[model samples]
Target: MLEVGSTLPEVSFGYIKDGKMTDPRTNEIFGDKRVVVFAVPGAFTPTCSQAHLPGYVALADKIKAKGVDTIVCLSVNDAYVMDAWGKASNAEEIMMLADGNGFFTKSIGMDMNTSDFGGTRSVRYSMLVEDGEVVKIFVEDPGRFEVSDAETMLKNL
Candidate 1:
C-alpha cells in the first residue's frame, strides 16, 4: 500500500463531464495542489453509497476551506456509473473518478480480490496529498470503515 511521503503513481482516472469522457493523469490532478482523495471498493455499494461518499459530499466545503483544491471519490466502476452516482447523491462539489479496471488500485498495492462480490476491487482508504506526495493516509481494514471517513479526514486536516 502507498504510505506517507509516497508519490502517487502516474495513471489516468476516467470521469464524465458535459456528457463526454475525461481521463486525467494522476500528476495533473495531484501535482501542485492539496487534494483529499478517498476510494471505495465499488460504486453504489451499501456503505459507500450510504455513508462513505455522502460524508465527503456533506463536508466538501469545509474540507476545501482548509486549502484542499479538490476532493475526489474513486471507485472500481465505470465512468458512467460513477457519474450517475455522483448525480444521485448530489455530490456536485466532489470529483467522481473511475478506476475502470483497477489498474491504479493495483499499482498502489491497495487492490483486493473478492472472488464473488465484484472480483478485483480497491480497499477503502483516504489520503491527503500535497504537490503529488502523500502526507497522510488512512486505510480501513477488511469490512471496516472507521479511519477513512470524511469526518476523520477533516479532523486530521
Candidate 2:
C-alpha cells in the first residue's frame, strides 16, 4: 500500500458540485493546493456516515485554518450517492469525491472488498497531500476506526 511520504497516484475522478458532474484532475482542482483526502469504504454505511465523515465535517474549519486548501472525502461510490450523502451529513466544507470504478483507490493500493458487501471498496484511510504528493497518512486496520479521525490529522498538521 502507498504510505506516508509517497507521491500520490495521478488519477481523475468525478464529483458533483452544484448538481453538475465535474472531473477533479482535468479541472486542476488540487494541482497547487494542499488538500486533505479521506477515503471510506462506502457511503451511507454505519461507521462512515455516523463517525468517519462527521469527524472531518466537524473539524473542517480547523483544518482549513491550518493552511489546508481543501478537505475532500473520497469513496468507491457513484457521484450521486456522494452528493446526497454530503448533503445529508451537512458537509458543506468538504468536497465529496466519487471513485466510482475504484480506479483511484486501486492506484493507491488501498482497494479491498468485504465478502458480505461484494465488491471493491476503498480502505478507511486519510492522507494529507500537497501539490499531489502525500505528506502524511492515517490508515486504519480493517474494521477498526481509531487512527484515521480528523483530530489526529489536525494534530499532525
**Best of the candidates, lDDT:** 1
lDDT of 2 by residue, 50-114 (tens): 99999999999999999999999999999999999999999999999998998989988999977
Superposed by TM-score, candidate 2 places the C-alpha of residue 20 at a distance from the truth, in angstroms, of 0.9
lDDT of 2: 0.89
Candidate 2 wrongly placed segments (more than 4 Å): none
Give each model's clash number: 0, 0
Worst 10 residues of 2 by lDDT: 22-31
Per-residue lDDT of 114 in model 2: 71
TM-scores vs. true structure, each candidate: 0.98, 0.95
So what's the TM-score on candidate 1? Answer: 0.98
Q: Write the per-residue lDDT of candidate 1 for residues 46-103, one digit (tens) a residue.
A: 9999999999999999999999999999998999999999999999999999999989
